[model samples]
Target: MTPTDLPVLTIDGDRVDDLESFTREFSTFLDDHTWRGNLDAFNDILRGGFGTPEGGFVLRWVNSDRSRQTLGWDATIRWYEENLKVCHPDNRADVRARLDRARKHEGTTLFDWLVDIIRIHGPGGRESEDRVHLDLR
Candidate 1:
């Protein structure tokens, strides 16, 4: 995707605070390893939260599959797992369920939500359209 097509989000401070707190707690859920698929824990860390901060959140996905397939996938997955501090689910339902929960949660922080955005859009291995001015509010 071109720079013009990149997506941007408004992540405010209040939202950032909630996400930071969640990240800290979520970090406790992971093992000190190089790689692991932990998406559920990550979702749990942000579900049912709210964003009070003033800034926006931006979501970007860089596809290195052609250049580094394993590395890209591993890095993306690891980032998601580590950020959310949760394990990946076996089916789409489980993943969706977790996201539903997090969205339901009140007062989601910015940092945490940013992680969520990344996780949701991380798959497919192809460059995506730049999504800007998405209404997160």
Candidate 2:
């Protein structure tokens, strides 16, 4: 199925009451699809969302910039750290390396990476204009 044919996971930044609530909602959404609440699971889902028949999905973020400040930076970093702790030792190094790279990338936040990844892998490949739709307004 095409990326547009898949379901869209909408995150309303304005409605995020707190981190706990956002976490709970996000986790619940992931759980509904049998996601394991880890980077691997997240990556798998992304892969599936991008034309993989097994995983088809889309993501829409409203007020994404605000969400970045409210639930993007620290929360995503903490998630990476927490998931890394539970990951296999062999994989930890690679995960850490990626995390380090992500940190070093100027002006590129986790959310930005996520959106880019989706665009690169989805439908029209890297040049696909239908990237993760973010409503900054």
Q: Per-residue lDDT tens digits of candidate 1, residues 40-82?
A: 5443322222231122123322221221332233333434345
- Deviation in Å, model 2, residue 115 alpha carbon: 1.2
Encode model 2's per-residue lDDT on 1-137: one tens digit a residue.
32455567777777754455544445555533654334445555555443423444455667766766765656556656776998899999977876676566434555565555556645566534343322233
| lDDT agreement of model 2 with the native | 0.55
* lDDT of model number 1: 0.34
Candidate 1 regions off by >4 Å? 1-37, 45-56, 64-68, 71-137
Candidate 1 weakest lDDT stretch, 10 residues: 125-134
Clash tally, candidates in order = 41, 1
lDDT for each candidate structure: 0.34, 0.55
Instruction: Mark the regions of model 2 whose C-alpha exceeds 4 Å error after superposition.
Output: 1-9, 16-36, 39-59, 96-108, 121-137
